[model samples]
Each structure stands twice: as structure tokens, then as C-alpha cells.
Target: MTETRKTVWGVLSTANIAVNQVIPALQKSERLVVGAIASRDEDRATAVARRLGIARAYGDYDALLDDPEIDIVYNPLPNHLHVPWTLRALEAGKHVLCEKPLALSAAEATTLIETSKRTGKNVREAFMIRDHPQWLRARELVQGGALGEVRAIHVSFCYDNRDPANVRNQLDIGGGALFDIGCYAVAVGRFIFACEPERVVAEVDRDPDFGTDRLTSAIMVFPGGRRLVFTCATQLVRSQDVQIIGTTGRVSIAVPFNQSPDREARLLMDDGTVLKGGDPAVETFGPVDQYLLQAEAFSELCVSGSVDPYGLQDAVRNMSVIDALWSSEETRGWADVRQD
Candidate 1:
């Protein structure tokens, strides 16, 4: 019997997402092992390591990267820091899973792609929602004719955050609704439609005090003339959902963006069922920890050297849409997404 070697992972920050979602997931994955965690303060790193049962703790990010034993690193740093850390990890001959909005714009994402190629290591932007079975099921339903010729996608993700100091509400560290939640909106639309948007239009409102964008709404026209509209906000009632409206029927997901582990998720499609005597076709998925599944999937890629679905190229596409949206905001009109 061949002994399976686990992919050893180090974490680059004590960010809440890393601690709450990712670390727990890594701890639970069969193919991955938690090697260490890093913080600027040695005591803080040591405390987090002890609390999370990580084997080692380093006082600085480079210490873990400098370690020859770690195979990969999970970087849940500030949005602006994501690309730099991932580049460093790749240069060290380690794979990277960096939290999304992989980079500030398409240009940086392209740089990441080049860095990955030069370093001979891979970096996958961590968009955990893409790994969720719910999304997979949605893609299946959309492409399988459950919804005939999807014409429009609507995604809404928002949360009310009045805190001035939170990174999402700050201007310097790349804080805003578009970067915070719109990434998911754009990603899910692209994944379901399997196409790129040709043009984009966007509206954004800035916070008076912080100069951070409080709300962002955008529309993208995709190949085959399909369309996606998504709105995200930093100060709004919490809501998350996605709908794929088609020519024949429409599929709707109840909890689309933020996959809460406490509740069951459902996908429903009505195909002239209400007018007729038939009930709507429905499927419900039991609770799943998407981050855990993401860890397992990424670990599998690291171990097998298989290509990641959301590698730097995919990240670049997503960022390009974001860039187009920002451009539209400036022009208050349509902006073209660069065709390849």
C-alpha cells in the first residue's frame, strides 16, 4: 500500500476568516496538515497556534515561507496584501490559496500569473463558494436544460456594517462593496454562464466620511447576449441570493452567496408548474462547510499537480470585470471589457 503524504499548509495571518473558516477546514481535511501560523507579533502567533492546534507559530510571514517543510500557504490578509503574499509564497516554491478579490485589478492579477509561471508554483485565489456543491448543482441545472437557455443572472450580496474601522469600510486597504462581496457575484455568474461579459455599467456611492464605496450595482452583457446584474453594499440589510432566469423556466437559490452551515440550501425551478397542476421542481442540499471542501480540493490539486479551476487566469477574468465596473462608475456609462 502506498503511504499518502499530506500537504502541509501554513497560514499567513490571524485574520478572522483564516481562523474561523479556513483553519478549522484545514484541520478537518484528510489530505492536508496544518504546519504553522504567522503574525507580526510572536506572542500573538503563538497564542493562535496553540488555540488552533497548529504545530508551529512564526513571528513573521517570511519565517513560515522560509521553512522548507511547508508545502502551501493560506493567505487571508488584507485585500491589498493578497497578491504580494501569494507571489512570495510562489517564489518560495510553495503553492498559495489567497482569499478573493485576488488582486485590486486585472493588471495585478496578470502579474500574479506571470509570477506563478516563472516560479514554477501555482496560486489559487480562494473563492470557497465556487467549490460548494450548491454552485455545482446550480451549474448542472442551468446547463442541463432545467432552465432552457439562461438569459439573465441576478446576484445580491450585502451586509450592514457601520463600523468605521473595519477593513471593508476603510479606503486605504482596498475596502468597498465591490471588492468585498461583488467578487462572488461576478464569479458565480461567470461560472454558471461559462462566458465573459462584453460590456459593463456600474453605479457606486461613496461613504462621506471614509471615501469608501458603500454600495455598488453593476450590469454586464455576456456572450450570447446573456446578462448579469448584481448589487452589493456595505450598509444594507443582510441578503444573499442568486437567480438564473431562462427562456423556459428560472432557477432560484435561497442561500446563494454565503453558504450558512446551519441551514439547508434549496434550488427551485418552476416550469409552467404553477399554471398547471404540477409543483415546482426542487432540490435541497444538506448543510456543508464550503471552506472545508475548498481546503480538500486545493490540497488535492497541490498533491496531484492538477490544474485549479480558479487559478490566476480565472482571477484575472474576475478582476477584469471589476475593473470594467469601476471604469463604468467613473464614466457613468458603459465600459467595454477587453476581449481576448
Candidate 2:
């Protein structure tokens, strides 16, 4: 007998992330089918559906969620909308894979977690960096004691988002350097250290015109006294790097964070040995394919009645750190993460 296909998926927005990544990924995944595409504008939704060859297009997000054929909902909406739509999808009995910074605040993320439990649905935050092979290998090295007692970590993810009208510069929509790029730094820090930070201290620079943060630098101290110094900027040139320093040696990965699953990445050790990895020729179909992998993982969990590595609970903890960092900036001191 032939095995049945795994899932029927929907796109929650016509955002670039979906247009470029998710749609193509769904087309590529053998286990999934693109059921529909949704946008606030009818024409845009129709156009995207045609371009992606999706069966249906809905002008309203709720319509897509209400569709019985859509088993998975890929939400790439603005940051502030993540929580609401995710909760709506869960309540509608659709598995949700939402983009990063899962929700604008920790409270919102907590609500998502609780709702998922009560509703018995799967909800995950799209942190593709963790899903890539290189990142997985790095984590294994750190966790396996190959690095021998990690001492400090330094990470940076900065890029120029010069579009004044772009949502990344909008505060009300939950746009800022911290929400956009700083999230990756925080994720890498947590993964390298294998735990949440015990304390967070940060400083943020607000754009005079946009009124949103243009830059943020934060220092997180982890349980084993490991320090992670990181920075993110929306007004600077593109750069991504991560370094893990230990007592015996150290490891560094160039372009350590991003959507590129197949880019050339290097691991440098203290002994002057450089282990090369990642494929420079492998082009990223964009964040969507990563989202598909994420979707597949979530579906496996749903099928086996297991929990994902990065579930709604993990999203809440990550957001708690984000909230604490912002609060630390306001208080001008280190702030402890408040868990629910």
C-alpha cells in the first residue's frame, strides 16, 4: 500500500517570507500540499495563489484558518499579529508555525503556550537557524564537551534595513532591532550555553524619526557563569558571526546565523585547525523551506504524540529573555527573567 501524504498547508500572509520561502518549500516537500494562501487584500491573495499554484486564496486570515483542508498554518505576519493569529489557528484546530519573536511580549507568548495545551494543538516558533545541520553540529560539539567548558560567547547579527516605511522601523507593529535581528543573537547564545541567561543587561538606541530602536547591545550571563555579549543593528552593514570560547579551546562559525542552510561555514579551533563545512553552491529557497522542515517536525510530534524541541513553552522562555533585556535597558541595570 502507498503511504499517505502528511499535511495540507496554508500561508497566513503574502509577506516576502511566504512569497519567497514558504510557498516554494511546500511545493518541494513530498509530504505536504499547498492548500491555500491568505492576505488582507483580495487581489494580492489571488495573485499570490496563482503565482504559487495554490488551490485557493482567502482575503481574510480567519477564512484560511477555518478551512478544513488546511492542516498546517504558516504565519509570517508582522510581529504583533503573531500571537493573535497563532491562537486563532490553534483554536481552529490547525497546527501553527509562526515566525520568530513568536509574540511581541512574554505574556503573549505564555498565552499561546497555555492555549496550545488546552486546545491540544501544536504551535512552534520558526527559528530556522537551529534546524540547520551546521548549527546542530555546533550544539553537539558544545554539549559533548568537545569544547571543554565553554567560557564566553560573542555573537552579532546586523543588517541595513534602510527602508523608512518598512515595519522593522515601526514600533507599534513590534518592529525594532531587538525584535528583528537581536533574536538570532539571543537564540545562538542560549544554544551555545545550553540554558537561559540568569541575568540580562542591555542598552537600546531609538531612532529619532521612527521612534523605534535602531540598535541594541546586550550582555547575558548564563548559569555556569558563561557570558554572552551580543549586538544587533538595523542601521548597519550586514554581518553575522558567533564565537564560543572555552578553557581548553574555542570554536568560531562565520555567518553562524541566518536562513542559509547550505552556505559555506567554517569552524576555527584554538589549535589553528579550521574545519570547513556548509555548501556555498546550495542556494536557500528562503525561510519558507526552513519553515517546512519546522512544519514536518511539528507534524511528526503530532503524529507520535510527542513534543518538539522548540515548542510554545520554549517560545515563551525566549520571549521572556527578550522582555527582560528591553526592561533592563529601561531600568539601566541587569534584570532577571520572570517565568510564568
Candidate 3:
């Protein structure tokens, strides 16, 4: 007997992320089927659905959410809309795989988590870097003491998104360099360091025309004196890299920061040894594959009743760090990360 496919997914936006990444990933995953695409504009929805070969198209998000056949919902909506639509999806009896920064603030993230628990549904943030094999290997190596007690982590993610009308330039819709790119740096720091920072200090740069931050630099100090210094920007030449230093040696992840990085990451030891590897074929890298992995993982949770690896708790914690960073900038002093 042939094994049955595991999941059917609905996409809630016609955002570029869906068109470029998530749709292709769903098409590639053996465990998932692309069910439908939804956009606020009927014509755009139909066009994206037809172009992507998705079977169903909905003119509105709720119509797609109401479809019982859609087992998982991929939400790549704007940052401000994440909590509202994710909650709506859960209430509609659909599991949600929302893009990162989970919400504009930690309080919003907490509300979503509480609602997920109340509804007994799976809700996860889409932090695709965690699913990458190289990062997985890095985590294993670090956890196993290959680097001899991690002392510090340095990461940077930057790109030029200076378009006046780009969503990242819009303040009210939750557009800012910190929310867009800083979340990745923060997530990576927390993931590798194995704890959220006790305090955050940050500086932000705002463009005159946009009235939103275009660049940010932050320092996170974790317990045991480990430090993660990170920078994110929307007005710089593209660069993405991470370095972890320990007592015995160091590991460098070349271009580890991008939505799609083509170079193999490098690992170096104090003994003059170097290790190099490329992206895993088992997963797709960049915005699209990341969303797909999130979809597949949520499907597995629904089918098997397993704990979500990147669950609501993780989302809340990440948002809390973000909130603290913003607070640090506001007061020009270290802000303690608030936890609930």
C-alpha cells in the first residue's frame, strides 16, 4: 500500500516571500501538498494560484482560513498582522507557521501563545536557519564541546532596502531594520548561546524620509558572561556572517546570514584545522524553503502530537528580546529582557 501524503497547506498572502520561497518549498516537500493561495486582491490571488499551480484561490484571507481542507496555514503577512491572523487561523482550526518576529511585541506574542494553548493547536515562528543542516551541525558541535566552551558570538545581517515605498520603510506597519533583520541575529544568538540575554544595549539609525529605523547595532549579554554582538541594517551593502569564539578555537559561518547564501560555511579550530560544507539538499535555503520547513514541522506536530520544536514559547522569547533592544535604544542604557 502506498503511504498517504501528510499535509495540505494554504498560503495567506501573495507577498513576494510566498511567490519566491514558500510555494516552491511546498512543491518540493514530500510531506506537504499546496492547497490554495489567498490575497486581498482577487486578481492577484488567482494569478499567483495559477502561476504556482495551486488548486484553489481565495480573494480574502478568511475564505482560505475557512476552508476545512487546508490543514496548515503559512502566514507571511506584514509584521503587524502576524498575531491577528495567526490567532484567526488557529481559531479556524488550522495550524499556523508564521514568519519571524512573531509579533510587534512580546505581549502580543504571549497572547498568541496562550490562545494556542487554549485552542490546543500548533503555532510556530518561521526561523528557517534552525532547520538548516549546517546550523544543525554547528549546534551539535558547540553543544558537544567541539569549540571548548563558547565564549562569544558575533553576527551581522545587512541589506539595502532603501526603497521609499518598501514595507520595511513603513513604521506603522511594523517596518524597521530591527524587526526585519535583527530578529535573525537575535534568534541565532539565543539558539547558539542556549539562553536569552540578561540585558540588551542598542543604538538605532532612522532615515529622515522614512521615519523608521534603517540600521541597528545591539549587544546582548547572556549568563556566564557570554556576549553576542550583532548589527542589522536596511541601507548597507549586503553582508551576512557569523563567528563563534571559544576558549580553544573558533568557528566561522561564511555568509551564514542571508535568506539564500551560496558559499559553504567554514569551521576553524585552534589546531589549524578547517572544516567546510555546503547547504543541505534535504532542505531549501532562503525565505521560501524556510517557510516550507515550518509548514512540514507543524504538520508533523498535528499528525503525531509531538512538541513543536519552534513553538509559541520560542516566539514569545524572541519578541521579548526585540522589545528589550528597542527599549535599550530609547533609554540609551541596558534594558533587562522581560519574561513572563
Number of the top lDDT candidate: 1
Over 1-340, each residue of candidate 2 has an lDDT whose tens digit, in order, gives 0126667888898999789876776687777788899999989999989977889999999999989888878889999999989989999988888898899888878887677888888888888777665677678878888778887889888888867789898889999899987888888877767788888999999889888888899999888788999989999899887888777667777566654534454565553343354322221223234555666666666666676778877888888899999899889999998755
lDDT for each candidate structure: 0.87, 0.80, 0.82
Per-model TM-score versus the true fold: 0.95, 0.91, 0.91
Screening candidate 1 with a backbone cut-off below 3 angstroms (N, C-alpha, C), the clashing residue pairs are: none
What does candidate 3's lDDT look like per residue over 1-340, in tens digits? Answer: 0136658889999999888877887788888888999999999999888988999999999999999888888899998999999999999988888887789998888888667888778888888778765677677778999778898888888889878788889999999899998999899988998877899899999988897888899999999989999988899998888888887667777556444533344443342244344332222223334445556666777777778767988888888999999899889999999866
Pick by TM-score: which candidate is best? Answer: 1
Query: In candidate 1, what are the lDDT values of residues 1-340, reduced to their tens digit?
Result: 0127888889998998888888887787777789999999899999999998999999999999999889888989999999888889989988898898899989988888777888767788888878887789889888898778889999989999989879998788899999989888888878998888899999999999988889999899998889999999999999887888998998888888677766787887787676678787888888888888888887787777777777888889989999999999999999998764
With candidate 2 superimposed using the best TM-score fit, by how many Å does residue 246's alpha carbon deviate from the native?
1.3
lDDT (Cα) of model 3: 0.82
| Higher-TM-score candidate of 1 and 3 | 1
Look at candidate 1 and tell me the lDDT of residue 152. Answer: 93
